[model samples]
Target: MKQFNQFAARPSAMSRALRKAFVYMTLAGTPALLSTAAYAQAVANDESTSATGVGAGDAALPTVTVNAAGESGQHLQTQSANGALGSRSVLDTPFSITSVTADDLADKQILKLGDVFSNDASVSDNSGGYSAWASYITIRGLPADWQNSFRIDGKPFLGYGITLPYDHFERIDLLKGSSGFMYGFGTPGGLVNYISKKPTDTPVRSVSVGYTSGNIWSEHVDLGGRFGNDQMFGYRLNATHDQGETFNEGYLRRNSVSLALDARLTRDLTWDFQSIWQNSNSDDQTPSIYTANYTGATLPSVISGGNRTLVGPGQHLNTNFQLYQTGLTYRINPDWKANLSYSHSSARRNRNEQTIYLKNAAGDYDNYRSDYLEAHTYDQWQAMVEGNARTGFLEHQLVFGASWQKQVNDYTVNSIYQLSGTGNIYAQNTNAYYSNTALRTYHAGEITQQALFASDTLKFSERWSVLAGLRYNQFEQNAFGIGGNRTSTYSKNATTPTVALMFKPEPNTTVYTSYVESLEQGGTPSLGQDNYGQQLKPLTSKQYEVGAKTSQQGWSATAALFRIERAAEYTLGNALVQDGQSIYQGLELGGAYRPAPQWQLGASLMLLDATYKKGSTFTGNRVAGAPKNMATAQIAYLVPQVAGLKLMADAKYTGNTMLRAANDIELSSYTLFNLGASYTTRLGKYDTTFRAAVNNLLDKRYWQYQYENYIKPGDPRTFSVSAKLDF
Candidate 1:
């Protein structure tokens, strides 16, 4: 057999035999499925619903819709008889919004947050085996953090993190492109809004349990019901638990759990309350970046291994984040509504290391302390009222609203230090005297944005309409003085105007063009420079995009072209230091194609040319970790009905790109494949499924996923078999 990769293992005889059988069976079902597709042409406009076991006439199903994120918030589609409640989903607009329905998730046996990204070719996650909490997403080949915003049921949250769980959400809406206008402060990297399940007007009782390979287990239950003839009172409760272990020893064992509740007190008043607590602990077997092990593979270690960089015996990372939220909505009337919501998240993370590495010229690689500990408790509250109606000069509609959002990060630990790589080293820390206390440190100021906004959608004619929006914002930041309370505050007034023309000649197609801008605070100050505070300023960026979208029957697709420009950016800083200022720009082309009711294909390509024109910020140097050319594509096909047997196969490939623009240091491109299948049957009244999935089927090896490499590697091939029971 031809060699595949450092981590690659030859396919077993059983696996090969199964693949052959599946190929033949799937080929046999192709025609039947094709015929089904023809019948679906009549309802193709609503076809994205195919996987959910619902037809255009499935009026018996309950209402499950989200109006909080993406353009989808502008289009409402659900299984309810009275029509979808709340806002319209992005799928109906010119913008791109891909929504994964609950039924589709169940059919695919998706068990975690990471699994969902498989459906979106425009996204990437690099924190494979080291830490599930280290998950990062990229769009249009932009630095994963370029400019992306995140929302949960219309509520906005900032910072970097991973998905909590899939069990609590009814669906996930991926709103591609700049979402800053509605999400408040955020990156340019589109947006992801997790719509949690809410209270229903009818009672429902369901529970499920899933067990996967790698010592994985999951249990979830949801109960909801209504009281009174008018059903003025309703409540819903949800809970889930997950725990698992991986194939690698160092990169093992993780879990999360949470609960949510919703109550409707009256026709005009309602409340949503939720609480979640989760903990993730692992050895962080960080893989290698520029280098690899005895095997010629350059890919980072799939798991943190090697006795040399022990990071200390029993070294591990511990992370815990908890959240609480409450919201009140008043219908006020049929055409108008108002809402007030407050969300809070407290996170505590710590890394204990006992690793040995080459730290100095003495050819000595010893135990060293590299700390990026974080402890933050942030909160955001917003209140807004909006109304919609039809009138003259417009046959369409209108929506106008205003609100305030406030977020504050507390006890921010932004510091760096050096320490022993091993516990058995001669450089044992003098806990007796606490030497080497001279490590550098600095504190960051609070970032705040207060704004006033308004928007209007005018239907000038049947084929054209104008979306006009304006926002006035006052931004301020204070960088706290190190070792002292001295602080410097920087403030600015900014205005953003948005105008777009949407053309829709048919019910399932829309094409639109729009422009948006975003601003973010800069980095650390200069070391030994007691007050490097006043010199740092906020970085501002502008982006222009034009995209067209079409969705019908069970098929949805979108094509977009985008350009992003960054005028001010910070560079090279160490322990509270100021290093460089630069300008960045890039062009993007992307699309998602789901041609079949049971299969889909998609990809995105981002070409970038960025530089620091003046003053040697990176001075003629390409930025690190900012790859020049990057694109990923995948195809998924499902096996047709074979009694209780089903099959699925997919492949994803990433192109080579720069880890840093400077020196052209490149992180070569790579690709991976995935295959899965499940068997379903009914044991009495209970429904059950047995599934097995193998990721990175080829197990190719390569360097780290980012310019920082930071001693973290990508994930290796792993196989998991699971079973789920629903009753």
Candidate 2:
């Protein structure tokens, strides 16, 4: 274990506190003053450009306009953000990426982040349902790190025990494989970025009402417009409220509000501000089953006790979140630009979970309860410069920038845990033995990350190009005891690199190969291990990928082959250590085709082979929770006879999954079907739309594999309907 006797090498408590305050003040108050000065400079000069600014990029390229056609057509996105490298056409980018727009969410009536990409073969809902800790997903056969895998508006946020309303976001982007050179630190699995809706150039107003299975009801309002001379000021606002019983008999109430404002002081200078708030409460959530004690090769059947809500009274999860941000963009000239931004976000959570421990394959279990209270705050600042230059025989698009981020965490010392009672899966229970109570909280720890990155795309000809990027990162973690004294400190730094080569056979075709490396926070030893509570060194991951993409004649297709090798951590002879490696190799194929003017078809398939390599009992065994094959297909038909009516159906298939490192137990394969329809028409001078969907139409009972000791029940059949009006 590492020692913690270096207090003299660190800053004093008073200095640390002052530094934190100073950073807060700078982030909160500096943007406005800086923008004022830029505005004055802008007014003094009449030379300006009308081009929009690219966000969070070292190279300030022209912004790509996202329109309704991109949202409602073809089921394919043309452009996606490549981290600090800016946005590129999907066909031209060397990495695999995907985006889901607001229109898709509304059509499917999706409420949670996991459900947004349920049809993608490369993604899986690991938790199967909402969690008091966090909603989790698995990408490329690895679970994403909930603490560090999420971002908002190109900035970092703590993704613990909070769910933001989807209505506030215009789009969600996913970057697959190692992103160390683009993003400072993250898991190799992937990254999820939520792009909030911004102010519009035209006037807009809309209202919507929706209902889901079990009588859940929701109302939403959206408003946006510009005002002042030459429409120099713009604003967009969204508000929503929902309350009712869930399909599994759980009750929930949620409220959220988001606002975006921008001031175009001059054609070449722009400033923007954003604020978001959300509060949600859930009760009687469906309980997850613990299979550690069953010891049976054959687990309990899903139909035996699946879809059962074991939660009783006094059990609930409540969360609150808030975020504020400000940024300024200045177009130095047509060939170059500069950007600066700062943001702060916080989350608070209080939750109690009802847990069940399985005793046998016949559905008997012991009931228990667990409680948690935690708060997290984060602050980040970023600056970038981007430009285009040509020298002799090559043209270069260059970007360079730096960023700093810090997070402070507070948690209860020891959460309350109590045994409620014992019961059988076939029986029923609805009594509470304990009530929610307050617990003492203490400062847990803090983490800081800093990065400097640069990238260049060298275009040698219209048909060939190369991209090279590098990032230098430093990470620090400090642990504190309950008495407010620092117990341990860890600091590490590394430089990651990425390189790619591309070839374009045609205007709409691209073939590429890329290699990248990443570093991620390591795992801590669990109970019963010889080194329990000891933190390990950072783990490194590497990936190699080759892919091809094309879009032509109302159709698009993509194919990729990749391999990832990540360091593994497991118990060896009752001692936890980082050794060996987990290797994952996979092939992915996806496409969309508009066979005719009224018909659209889409499909995706993934084949993965994952294994653990080491001289141990787990050697050569299939990785736990990884599936070998996954497939999805969907079709939509626009009725030629009806003016604006569309019908759609989709199906997904998942192969058997390993449930333990020993590979002695496995989950059965399952397939699901969904159906939906939408109609658009004019209602009393208002453009109106009505949508309906039936998820899990076949009502199949299945178990979602999470890890070695936990399994969750798939949601039951559910129905949803909604209506929206635009004015």
Candidate 3:
């Protein structure tokens, strides 16, 4: 049952008369501006009465109180960091987390990180979108490892081939399975933090502008408040810029800056600071289709939708980034607390590429050309001491943490050349192979890690609880040859663990179970293997889970069932062995619902099997980008009488995936749809919003990633718009 065909092409006639005059002037002037502003606020009154009356007492009006802090507008979020047993709730976490907020990343206009994790169906998008270099993702079926699974407020940043900037984030959690006792050596597939954006005791000003179809264009700014006085300082700022051409024939540019600062220093102590900078550029750099040696060919046809250019406009990509952070929080009073943090990050890149390989089934191709120079650095330090106590029925929430991380990756690869193409996958003519080639570095590398951790959470009654964790790791690696000496070095040490159990029968339900472990960082042997660079040994993984969570009234939900296992290394004949075992089992579901008060709903689902149970020869197969059902859904409304209009729709589905691991090629199954609208009011006193969208919406031409004989495509129909202001 694999059938798809729909691209009847329509939208032009001046784009259907400008989308029917912008939806009939926004549904006919939004109920006449909500009935003339509800009849001028029903005969305005502005009450005033006691100027000196009974008792002539005017001294009783001297109490003014205003207290409001941050993050509200909850689109489902309830604390985070469950693996380290820190931050809690989500019905007292046991596992499986997903937060995403900042108003759900500006109502899903998210620009990357796979657009807010594609609404989480256990995430999967191994760089098939927004890649001007790298982004790769995959969870619940491995992959992930952008420098040890990324994080920001919880430290560790500069995730490998970078591309981070989610407009100064303020939420984005996602922690699904095995976080090596809360991050040690990673990749059992899960973890992503990013929470910054603080410093707000009040005031903030905003601005935004955007456009997208292929002409891109964007601008953004945000600033925040409080300074001196009894306020004791605070600040926040975010800036951005984006530029042009990219719905295929490639071209992009970006810039960013962020800053945050805060200080209180006396009552309970506090201090925080942050900084960021980014830069990017790209031009003609798309290519990533390998076809590991064509074989049973015949699968090339599907390239409708413009912007073809198979790489040659001289291809280029560039990136630069930086970050610095600091933190300190001390309470040490009602239940104790002490924390410390530090972070440093860096990234750099320069590349030129043109891959493509498929030399059969008539789509004749071949063009290799490669070049790259990269650098990454990350450093982290953390200290924690937390406590809570109660002994009547046994209650304790304790944490003891210690962390130190260091990462350095300096890579260089230059000139691979195989150009002199034979292209033709349906009319290809990249300006007759635009030229310019001169590069020279040949190979180099480096890697490192260090860790130590601990945690606890217990509570004996009021619906039981328990959590435990541990970590200890040390790893190092290096490889540099091509004359620069040092052909390899590897070091290792390990320990990881986690445990959880919880039950609450009703204050908004919860039931859970967990066990975890993970560790990774091993690899060498390349250049036709046979102990080419050797150095391997460091991989361990395991997970087991069961979960449930719920929230009532405004709805929230979560579910899980998991199993993971690993240790699969290959090459028995040339001897790079680990002698098999890989498994993944799953079922996950996610939720949110509002039902009324202007409806809202969200959903997620994933199935997954990911086998290769124990193999010498692909035993049970299946596992290559692992996919076995995935789903997502979303809906939003609000317009109950038009005040601040809203509307939205979303969908995504994926299934049937497998491309190698001897599963005999697969990849087919797709679905996508999107639609949106937004509006808010006020223009004179400031506060305005406007947005529009229409993505993919029935213009299907699938394929969203399948490596090992490549495939990437996905993303066609597009259109976008935006506006925002608040003073």
CA lDDT scores, all candidates in order:
0.51, 0.75, 0.68
Deviation (Å) of 377 in candidate 3: 18
Q: Could you estimate the TM-score for every candidate? A: 0.74, 0.87, 0.32
Per-residue CA lDDT of candidate 2, range 1-727, in tens?
A: 0111232236345434434543443333232223344533353232222222323232222222222222243333456666667657667788887777888778778756667776688887665444553366778887777667888887777776677788888988778787777777787888888888899998879877777877567777899999999999999999987766677666777889999999999989999999899999877677667665666788776742223446666677888999999999999999998889999999888877777777888877887777768788989999888889999989988888999989887877777666788887666756465544766578877889999999898999998999998989999988788899998898989988989999989888889999888988776553334665455667899999999888877688889999999987654555656768888899989887777777778888889998988635677988777789999888877664444566778888888888766677789988889888776644435566667788888888888776455677777778887777788
For residues 1-727, what per-residue lDDT tens digits would candidate 1 score against the true structure? Answer: 0112221244345434434543443343333333344433343334446525654444222222211112111122432110011255463343455577664455445534445665555555454444433445555444444212556666554334344656667877766555545555555556677677767766767655554444444556667777766665566666655444443444333355555555667768888776666666555334222211112223222332222232233345667767778889899888777877788766665554432332322223434444445454556666666667678767433444444544444332354445433232223222111222343334444666776666666777767876766666677765565564746777888776656678877766778887777655453332222433344565566767677766555444566666665543433332222344344455544454545544555555556554544444456766444555555555544444333444556555555554433333345666667776555543334454455667667665554454242333345566654444445
Candidate 3's TM-score reads 0.32
Give the per-residue lDDT digits (tens) of candidate 3, residues 1-727.
0110121133235434434544544443344234455632332221113423533243122221111011212233366654356776656778787777776576567656766777788887656434542566678766676666777776776564467767678888878777777767767778788887877888889877666777666667789998887999899999877766767756676788889998998889888898888888766755666666666634576664435556555666778888888888899898887888888888886666667776666677776655656677787777877778877877888877777766765655443344656576566646333333554444465566766677777778888878877778777877777677887687877878788888889767878888978887654342333674455767898899998887777677778899989876544444455657778999998877775667777788999888877677888887777788789887777655445666777887877677656665677778778777666664434556667777767878865663334565665777776666677
Which model scores highest in lDDT?
Answer: 2
Cα shift from native, residue 558, model 3 (Å): 13
Ranking by lDDT: 2, 3, 1
The best-first sequence of candidates by TM-score reads 2, 1, 3
C-alpha positional error of residue 370 in candidate 1 after TM-score superposition, expressed in Å: 3.4
- Which window of 10 residues has the lowest lDDT sum in candidate 2? 61-70
Say which prediction, candidate 1 or candidate 3, comes out ahead on lDDT.
3
